[model samples]
Target: MSSKSDAKQEREIKIVGFLCNWCSYGGADTAGVCRFRQPTDLRIIRIPCTGRIDPLMIVKSLIQGADGVLVSGCHPNDCHYAVGNFYARRRMEVLKRFLPYMGFQSDRFRYTWVSASEGQIWQQVVTDFSETIHRLGPNPGLHQTVDSAPAVSWF
Candidate 1:
């Protein structure tokens, strides 16, 4: 029974989290310091600010085989960098809406606000997102043919 449970854990989904240093990253750190139990599926990447995260970074992560992506930043009006997270919110919203047109599931990417003091919230957020991704299963990325280039050429 233990081995079966371990095997189930081994099949857990893979998720990438992009956390803003000033707030969300601190929240995650606080959660760790508080010994909050959180899922092991999310791998965190710390960035200076959510505003600095390019939409393409999330897209690239999904295309590269990440099962899901989560972006967390400071709450609006509480951002250390003033309105940076507001800009990030708008950009993330656009990306969430545009993902489906590009053949990706919008639910696979999510953005949220987490304050440095919100350790428990961070744990909950990670746990909920992990569960959601597990339900969605792995992202299939773009299915393409050797003879066919992407509809939108990067070059």
Candidate 2:
């Protein structure tokens, strides 16, 4: 694999990852420090907690041409904020099912939990998601049609 072609591939297929600050982010950092090999397609955005992330953010990323979206947070019973991960799990599950209706592939989005000490698991999660995204290819964003077009003007 040539560097030039690899760079081009990375540019063409972008993966956005939203990670929890206290857990998932730390897990990612640990992976890096441990020198675990992972795909470079994932662009990480650290948030305080998955519970605080808006579903629209994922939608916006997909509309903006991101090939995939991966959200990782603390485990169900391990959230620093008590029930934050619970809320996130429900929201992400519904969003996953709803993505196809919005013209985005359901597999383009995924969510999971990873703790700071779980670097190997984080590496595997990222690797698997990256592979899935590579198979999906680039996202064309939401399509507008006569029926799907908005009739109301906000302004």
Candidate 3:
């Protein structure tokens, strides 16, 4: 892609961020409290732990119109549950190896470790991730909007 085209496209990237409540989420909150100016294109979803992030959720986020997905959690051995981030790291490694060949690019999905005190890191991560996705152009997967019907009530 030409530099001119890339520059024009950078203004439209949409990102979905999945942050672990104990660490990354706190980091983001701190960023906010500190008045850090971060990109507004990302929609954040807080999960109890990064291990709770299902790979399908990544695919689903893309399908629902996010051009990129950022999964952030505690550093190795620093998870609130002690080992949850390790499991998350393993799952992300395996998924990273396969998701791109199926259409998603490395820029379309990313995983990172951010601790509660790393507010600047969290801001920078989101800023940089969004910029990369912007430069890569949009993902075709993001155009596939969800169409499933509501689940049956169990009352």
Candidate 4:
């Protein structure tokens, strides 16, 4: 690839990954140790558990101009915290459904399961999600609404 194309690709794609510390994060680490090829566009945030992740955090990231968001945690019934991922799944599902309603594309957000031992899975997930985000392109962000009057009065 030419330098100009490489620079354009780097600048155009940004993916934020929220990974559960006990499972998904370990999976990513294992993938790295195993020398699995992974996408460079992802920025990982290691959270204690998927249950601790608020949907608003993902939304905030999108609002701030992330092209996509990926949330990965322990497999169902395999959570180290014993059910954290279950709650996370439900919350993520709701968020996924709600994003389109709020004017964001539903495809921009994704949630999945990956165990600590599933390094290959982690690599695949990152690759696939990164590709999907690339197809979706840059997020335009939320639209601003017109207000009748300014909140603060300078006069």
Candidate 5:
């Protein structure tokens, strides 16, 4: 019986979270302090600034079996670098366009602005993103069919 349930949950969506070191990370910490339970699917990675996020990183997450990606940072004009989030926002917009072209769904990536003081919003972001990904169904990346071919003798 436990095995069956485990099998059912084995393919659960993997939500990768990129959090800004100063604000969004603090917000997530606050959520924990308040006991705001979030989905277990999310795994957080802290970076110095949202601007440090690269399109390649997001692509690599998908390639590595992430069902979804969430990026959270300070709001406009609130970035520690003064314009980091704005730069991040523009980068995401362009990346979003290319991911779908690469066969990933648009909903697979999400971005938000969460400040250190917005603990509730941070909690809600995680909750809502989890639910949305749940509704969208499992990530197709997990279902990739590997081609098993016999090795040929090079000699």
Candidate 6:
């Protein structure tokens, strides 16, 4: 008989996580150092700050077949770069609402805050997001169905 983890691996799900170096990435590192048990579906990308992540980056991930996209950073008023998290929050919120119109479910995208000392919270965040991605299954991607891609440019 297969174990639970084996069963989880039966289906392939990929979640891309964009973590702010000052906080969320540190939290993930702390979680790893503490040996926290969490799902492995998430692949982390460390960014200087969430504000630096363009909304188009998330869209590109979806179009390239990422099952889910998660953006995490420091709590509001706690960003290392003053207002980076605030900027990130607004951009992500707009993207979240606009996802469905792009043929991608909004639930497959998320944004949250976490500090370096919050290892447990980070673990919970990753676990919940991973479970959500698994439920959504694989992404069909934009280029898969369309013969020609639309011109995507943001000023």
Work out the TM-score per prediction: 0.85, 0.84, 0.82, 0.85, 0.83, 0.85
Per-residue lDDT over 39-136 for candidate 6, one digit per residue giving the tens place of the 0 to 100 score: 98899999999999999999888878788999999999999999998888888999999989867888888999999999999999999988887766
Give candidate 1's error at residue 95 in angstroms: 0.8
Each prediction's Cα RMSD?
5.6, 6.0, 8.7, 6.6, 6.5, 6.3
CA lDDT of every candidate: 0.90, 0.88, 0.86, 0.89, 0.87, 0.88
Error (Å) of candidate 1 at residue 21 is: 0.5
On residues 37-91, what C-alpha lDDT tens digit does candidate 1 reach at each position?
9999999999999999899999999999899999999999988899999899999
Winner on lDDT (1 vs 6): 1
Error of 6 at 149 (Å): 16
Query: Model 5: per-residue lDDT, tens digit, 3-119?
Result: 545544768777999999989999999999998877888999999999999978988888786878999999989999999999999999999987887668878899999999888
Model 3 misplaced stretches (Cα beyond 4 Å): 1-11, 142-155
Q: lDDT tens string, model 2, 1-155?
A: 46544554655678999999999999999999999999998999999999998999998888888889999999999998999999988888889999887567889889999999999999999999998877766675656655665576789
Among residues 3 or more apart in sequence or in different chains, the pairs in candidate 2 whose N, CA or C atoms overlap within 3 Å are none
- The lDDT-based order of candidates, best leading, equals 1, 4, 2, 6, 5, 3
lDDT of 3: 0.86
Q: After superposition, which runs of candidate 2 have C-alpha atoms over 4 Å from their true positions?
A: 1-10, 144-155
Cα error, candidate 5, residue 8 (Å)? 6.1
Candidate 4 segments exceeding 4 Å error: 1-10, 144-155
Candidate 2 at 18: error in angstroms? 0.5
**Candidate 2 CA-lDDT value:** 0.88
Each model's total of backbone clashes: 0, 0, 0, 0, 0, 0
Model 4, position 50: C-alpha lDDT score: 96
**Candidate 3 residues 40-145, lDDT tens each?**
8788999999999998898788777678899999999899998998988988888888887765676688999999988899889989998887776776554346
Model 5 residue 49 CA deviation (Å) reads: 0.5
lDDT of 6 at 95: 91
